[model samples]
Target: MIGAYTIGKKAVTFGYKRYGIPGAVASGGAALAGYLIVRRALKRSTNADATGVESAIDAGEVKSAVEERGLGAVTESETLERAIDEEDVGSALDMNDVQSAAESETDAMTEGSEGDSSDER
Candidate 1:
């Protein structure tokens, strides 16, 4: 038992002083390098359309449509028109929506505080 304990103590001391910390650091660096390499490979493989712009926009379909309608064209093509319409609708949050959301949040806070007050009483 003493011999085993002495062996274990020496092993632990040597490992702590020499190999263990360096080995752990090297392993961590290798893992990080592997992760980065895999991430780069995945990104490259999936980047068929790197710009991420829609085919219609990339091909100048919107410009051609506008040109066909003349320089003073007020009407957009269906594709461009729909895209603009979507953007407008998404951005057009009215004051009523904000007021209702605020009121609901205030009501919830008041209700929670009322419950807590009753519990204290």
Candidate 2:
């Protein structure tokens, strides 16, 4: 958003220097559109996170970082973004367990198919 605002400022403030009034208007509109696009994207992100997601963090589920932060500045609903360091939604997935379960299922399927094929033959 800051970037968008800066771009809009530059476009409107100095666009006239290069391309006159028409260019200034065009650039200003483009910049405003870009800013609006970013604003909508961010709003959707927050809404999606706040509404609900599969295995996503619940409102009561306080992350360690939040605890560390002491919740002093935390909002009533921040959507508690799932960033790389946050481990918000991703931490729920323990890959090793999922892998083992998949491997077991594959082995069972292989055994069953082998028995069926031999019986048919």
User: What lDDT score belongs to each candidate, Candidate 1 first?
Assistant: 0.33, 0.39
TM-scores for every candidate against the unseen true structure = 0.26, 0.34
Candidate with top TM-score is: 2
Candidate 1 regions exceeding 4 Å error are: 1-90
1-121: candidate 1 lDDT, tens digit per residue = 1122333344344445656876434433333222222222222323323222122121222223322442122122342332222222323333333333334443554477689999998
Cα TM-score of candidate 1: 0.26
Clashes in model 1: which pairs? none
lDDT of 2 at 47: 35
1-88: candidate 2 lDDT, tens digit per residue: 1244455566666557778998677656544443333223333333335222222432222222233343221222232333111233
The prediction achieving the highest lDDT against the true structure is 2
